[model samples]
Target: MEGDGWRDIKVVRNPYFSLRIVPTVVPMRYLELAQLYQRLEKTTLKTLKTRLVADFLKKVPNDLLEIIPYLILGDVFPEWDERELGVGEKLLIRAVSMATGVDAKEIENSVKETGDLGESVALAIKKRKQRSFFSQPLTIKRVYDTLVKVAEISGEGSQDKKLKYLANLFMDAEPIEAKYLARTILGIMRTGVAEGILRDAIAEAFHVKVELVERAYMLTSDFGFVTKVAKLEGNEGLAKVTIQVGKPIKPMLAQQAASIKDALLEMGGEAEFEIKYDGARVQVHKDGDRIIVYSRRLENVTRSIPEVVERLKRAIKAEKAIVEGELVAVGEDGRPLPFQYVLRRFRRKYNIEEMIEKIPLELNLFDVLYVGGKALIDEPFIERRKTLEGIIEADGWIKVAENLITKSVEEAESFYRKALGMGHEGLMAKRLDSVYEPGNRGKKWLKIKPTMENLDLVIIGAEWGEGRRAHVFGSFILGAYDPHTGEFVEVGKVGSGFTDEDLIEFTKMLKRLITKEEGKRVWFEPKVVIEVTYQEIQKSPKYRSGFALRFPRYVALRDDKGPEDADTIERIAQLYELQERMKGKKIA
Candidate 1:
């Protein structure tokens, strides 16, 4: 396509809100683009001139002028794909190359001349050509598949390979196609749309309900599956795929209960209460001698916790089994240590043996997922718990979690208080008849934290920060639930808990959605939901809603939750009541 033709399509694909203008499509050709540019008005021509220059400037090595466009656009980096590339390395290489255009051999001499690749790309593009190569059609499925393939092929030490692959993919793509390709590859869509937006788009494209799409995604974690099914059997094909046994399902979460009484009430008098441990959630899969340890997200973490793998291989009686449990670090006294201590062991690289010696872990078994090559997810919790208890032998390295079956909510509440007194989080309330359902968050499993405070907040806006927060979004402004109007009311802001690196990364992220400016802040469409943590809940007149959180911090961004699922003002009031009651209490 002509450069102008590509630019026209770009304009059409990315139109400003309230603008209904459309561009004419023309045959792809450089000469045609040149002609179109010549016919354009001075103002239009001036706007097109910069991009044309930028395209030319990007030929330099280590120039961000070349890298920024690619990052913003999302294109394949054939140059870096020889291996999987870390976020830092990829950005550095792109920046360096765009800045100096010098070969590696000449970088030492040119480094002083061009400080960074981004600067170079910006400078170069300002004076570079308007057109060169065109890109392939971009889609979310393609981007996700490419990442998976990269992860599969690169294994562990393939950073160069990954970047090279990305370069090759984007080398010939048109600038606009390149943009989406780059964004998709990074697993981010900064165009004022949250991750859920893609799910919504997929549902609309497939003509199916959001729930159907969600169920399919939960089962496969593969966006391509949805697209494939839509292409084959239409949206109905999504429903055709049902939850199957023998396949691991997402475990249910629990709410924190303040005391034994509280636990019993939530569980409706009778309940199966398990000691909520301060540890990591692990799913052990065993097939014959082969063993794998997966995290709650189904990520393969076998290598990180080899000791756990070895223990599973030795302790489990079944030849083939999959079990869910908590892996906690234990002190010499045999008591479980804090979760942070356990997490340090996960991040260890050098001196792993020494770290392992210092931080021994104990696996607290809960549910058995599979046994004898048959899936146990369809089985009731009581049956699965029995099977789990029967198969795993308690050793110094592994033991079954402390569990009890009680008919009174009072007993459950007592256990909750004991768990807290032991420096644990809270208790897990599970339905005895329930089966494991992977990736689905529902009331079947409720996590009862000690605090009554919970807020249902909507993401109203986000800001880009400096240093490490330069690229991704840094902090967000969360709004409260307005019961009367059923709308989100701006309440508080959360800017802490983010690392310097996160600030830089997220800043670049939020920049893409920079819409209209409001004083020092930029507003975004309310879409994302996040569950935040706080020391206490207090009434405040500063916000539109009379509430505020003390020491509020980002807990987890809730992609599964829609805006409507957020906590209400009434719920916040309940939490405040609990907080007040606990303030004056002195444990005997």
Candidate 2:
């Protein structure tokens, strides 16, 4: 290839995502991944997406296996690794301007039309002024190494160095390559190659069982290493993967059940109803005297919440163990504080002890994944609870969640009421025989929140206000994801709950993310997430999402969540069915 394009890879197109047939002499190139990304983006069939990744993996050389998966996932490092490029958006814009020789204002104009920074950069690279007639081929390894350097840069003039490095990189990248580079650097590949797809892909590429690959991925939380192990060591090696003490595994997720009776019925008449605390979900790892804590997203937040670490260090009976629990920030009155307060404590880099004194955390242990040098994930829920009961002697600061084991709906309702009376969110009804499956939402565990639980929705489009509100957005269109297609569909519009302060703050926050404007209504790239409370979920033709939220009201701006983290169309339908049931309607 001529110009500043990547080289040395042969391509084979497959109906499903697949490995390209590369000659032994030609090492894998970044172009191959870029092409795969393009193909993955074109098709909405998730099965094709899985095959595309599998095919890509089949052609990956053993040495590049570990690095390529991370690139494909758009993560420079493993999921548990905390390193980031540290380059800000303004700096990125400068880098783009320098690489393309396009005016910064012109690039911003392109963003308005293209609706995506990556796409605008790709368009800009078409007009790159410093293009070379013949340049060294860009390789995945070079890009990965360069990005690692960017992440490693720190303190005093680091921004300048990062900007220079990024500019040079974008200058070297071809139009298509630059598009993906922009997205990769921003950690928004948008390739629809979620970890689940890659897990299945690895299983198919290596002929190992999908369950084996999933277990390995779940335990390690790194597909690059899992792919490497699957490719080099096969199933035997994958089976060897186990949860380690310093590494944080993805926490098991619960399904949302509309009612307590429904959850108990799913759990074979008897279940464990534990109070669901309104707080952050945390995973604690104890190895000897040191303890590390991780959030629900596998973020390493040990330093942010020191009290949890010290408390766990002294509370655990075993030297090596991993447990999952909720860390609720309680107020001086002993009532649980809002999630925002605990979030601040979890995010503080300095004055952590000061924040701890102001917002004390109470740990309510629920499940144990590992203990006494043994992994208990394969054990039944009851056995794991029994093991957890034996592993920790609760001081007041740390205690197992209060729970009730009963088969009667009346008893379950009473337990739930007691929990709600205590100002908790609700109760978690768990199947006694269910085994813990990491990063999965299944009937094994069901969440029962009273009445209608709030929905986390993404803002798809917004309308500017009139008169006094003309300076800010007045109404916002909400959207939910369709996991199968990876598309966002409109569910409702919210305008009622914002204060004047909220309107000003939200308008400022969303202006930069605007994609296109049609009169007073402006479209967005689905970046901002807001929690919405609604009276009911009703079937409607007003939105393509097939369901809509009735009388929706804005709750809070969920800065912690992204579009993917928002609710799904499937959830909307589930809630709709639940509402119908509550109205005493019978299904055919």
Candidate 3:
């Protein structure tokens, strides 16, 4: 019993180091973070949680503060980094089973009861059949290093290596630490500490303004870097953060308008309207001759679209710039296909050239954020548009999106009809004086489609299929993101709109995400984003979001989006209210 307590508090020297790093240390126990997790779980007040994290950060040693931010986020690297633990649930269960000397069957049973692998690990440790007298207390440095090592492991028997590393952490952890350690490795940190909260915490901890911290985060898209910057250089360093060529920024989002006339009115009786193509949003960054393309979600997609790279390499006239556009999938007749066709090309890791030949793309440049070593986010939209138009040497494969500047509703409506006739979605309206804002959704920009009411929802739970549809998930329980709580709450479920081919691909993709199953009902980890259409919105007691979609139909799988980018519960409320006002009017 004394050894057990000793193993929870005593210092253990970390055996991991890189040849490049100078061996910076935190001088804290991993138990500190686990304790913070416990405290965060005990409260639902966001202010309290933010204050707790701010206090914890204020006490940290500055030598290696970067790792702590990512750790608290349950990630080994920054959000833009491609590295992940890549460890699935079964591998985690095996690691827990191996560490506690608990049988695999019993651990599985525990998972069934708890519905959380982390909790299962905590419970299994109590009945341990193995013990080590020489085991030392785990340090924050060791735990962080070990999981990062797990992420870096690849090629040939990597699962065995990942299992061994995780098991070692478990052997050294106390029960509470074991619970969080598992969850962190699985990338399911349930602390409700969203990036927004952490951003606020960094500001509070360092006595810097929240806006400065937010600007730095928006420019770099890396909270780890922001934390270290705030610690080392304070407010001055944070204010100086600028856009880099390779790192991706979170793209700006838009709101929806009822009609072209309404869009014109919202923009003060005049607006810049451009065709909104039915394609994935693509961000292009260039430095010298090198160029990188990113998807809407800031995913590095250079390898996925080789021809786009070639086209961009020769199309842009500037030596350094960051531009954005729509990369539409085009058919043999040169008509644009749906956005999923572009997503299919982006997701392919093998036979990419063949897929490119099968589905071609057209890049229509729209906005420019950076050029000549200066960020243009502060520039007015009209100026940015002029800059974008001047730099791009347009060709058939790559060109600027068609636009019309007008204050007349008749012209805007004609332009909208022309866009639809040209096989595009509709038109996007932007205020001439609006500045480009990253990761923001407001009235600065608006989307006006013929019927633009689709919602991007994440699948939270589902039911198994029946009869001929028995091979795949028959119905999916969908939820909208709640930014306030950092949770996805149920809004509706859809059992229709899936093609036979969709079922086959969905079965292959979703079987790996099964957390726990009960008869025909299965719960998922909220990874899959899908576009959905509904007849109307209704106040309902059946869903946690307090609203449900009427006759919801699945549109497409948004493989390009993550769960965080899904429509928010607030947005659903707005849409519901909008529908109520249009009760008598016929909606397209």
Candidate 4:
């Protein structure tokens, strides 16, 4: 047992690399990170968690520090990057089963017992009867490199190859290490160490202010790069991080308002109101002749919308700029379609050209953040609007979002109603003196939508949460009643706008009504009623209801209402028709 303990702590020399590579001689073992994971798992206090990660990061060598942030996030690449491991739960289970000589049935049973596949694999590996003698001990770099190779594997027998790489890692990983290795692969490393916590940890570890770390992260959208900058050049190096053409920055966000009058009041009795077009938020980055489009999540979607790329190339007169807009799909009559049509086009990976022709899009330019190597994020809204208007030559398909500058509350309300009448989602009210703040949901910007359109839906099911929400069900499966059939049909899932206390309370309520369990999803009897608000009603075939809700958010528990009192499919249909008629009248 003493010899085995020493072996577990021992840093084995790698047979894969030559002795000439100095770093290979002192390879950073995976045990260090595994130990950190164990500590973080046990350390529930936020301050203690941050301290553990900060100390752990400080111990990592500078060369390996670059990937540490990504590793901490349970990812190899930044969120903005397009690389995916493509390893599903079943594939991972197969790999684990193969590596440990555990029965596939035993693994499936373990998964059923434990809500998480990571925990299941760990249990299985701990009880495994066979072990490989020739396997090399895992290292942090080796694990990351193998996953990247798995992500790069494609075309014919890719699953087999991915499984093989995962098996290789499992064969060498100790039981504790295998637990986190599985979680990392599944992208559910639930140590409660999110990006924000990691940001604070990075600041503390490098002795820089949290603001500088945040700014560097905002500009680059890559924690790996931010960590590298923090380690090498300190605060001065972080200040050098600027808006570049190819890298996409996080889009600024807004808080929803109850009323336009309230929104205007929040903006000091005056605000710039723009029609909130019901479409995907897009950020266009132009460098020389190259045009790239990024989604709100900072995903590169340029290839998905070729027509938008071409239109933007001709619409913008700037040499280099980063502009934000909404890409709304248009009907054959040139009227903007519902947000779902645009979303479908955005999601398309194959036959994209066909979809582009079938569903034409109109770019609605709204804000400018960067131009001519200068970041306008610090500029006031009025100045940025001026700069945006000055540079863009609006064409029919690439026009600026319609706006109304108003100081009076009545005018703001009227403009908001007009925007909703025009089939827009809502009105975005911005303070005239506010600067463009990326990744912030401050009071500088407010989204005003009618709250009278709330729906009382039944909770039919729920899925287990991850990270900070690991113990409770974070999102609830919502359903609308089909009165004709007397059955509940799923409309969508609601995961946002719930407080931690609410989640805990609801989780206890859901546990009592659970009728069946399938993986992380727990199907409950339709007893709990909740009020929900959504941006739009979209036609979708993904749900049995034949409809879906866009951006669904929790309002409050409708304790006064029963499942029978829940909103029906008929009501949903009526809302959809009413929405269409409102848009039609505006078009006419």
- Top model by lDDT, which number? 3
Candidate 1 vs. true structure, TM-score: 0.63
Error of 4 at 499 (Å): 25
- Provide the lDDT at 213 for model 3: 94
Global lDDT of each candidate = 0.57, 0.83, 0.85, 0.81
lDDT score for candidate 1 against the true structure: 0.57
User: TM-scores across all candidates?
Assistant: 0.63, 0.84, 0.85, 0.73
Cand. 2 Cα-lDDT: 0.83
How far residue 190's Cα lies from its native spot in candidate 2, in Å, is: 3.6
Candidate 4 local lDDT, 1-588, one digit each (tens): 221212223334578965432212456789889889888878657788889989988777766777888887666777667788988778888999889899878888876666566777888888777777787888888998998899899999999999999988897888888988987886667575666678889999999889999988887788888887887789999988888788888777676665677678889988899998877788999998899888776777888898889888988899999999998988877666876677677679899988978998999999999999899999999899999998899989898889999988888778878887777777899999999777665779887776436688999999999999999998999999874444688999999999999999999776635656888898875778988889889899998888999999997776534464567787787667756655675588
Runs off by more than 4 Å, candidate 3 = 1-26, 94-110, 123-134, 461-474, 482-487, 499-527, 539-546, 577-588
For model 2, give the 10-residue run with minimal summed lDDT: 1-10
Order of candidate numbers by lDDT, starting with the best: 3, 2, 4, 1
The better-scoring model by TM-score among 1 and 3 is 3
Q: What local lDDT does model 3 show for residue 317?
A: 91
Error of 3 at 425 (Å): 0.4
lDDT of 2 at 127: 82
Q: For each candidate, C-alpha RMSD in Å?
A: 11.9, 6.5, 6.3, 11.9
Using lDDT as the measure, name the better of candidate 1 and candidate 4. Answer: 4
Pairing residues by index, what is the TM-score of model 4? 0.73
Please give the TM-score that candidate 2 achieves against the real structure: 0.84
Distance (Å) between predicted and true CA of 430, model 2?
2.4
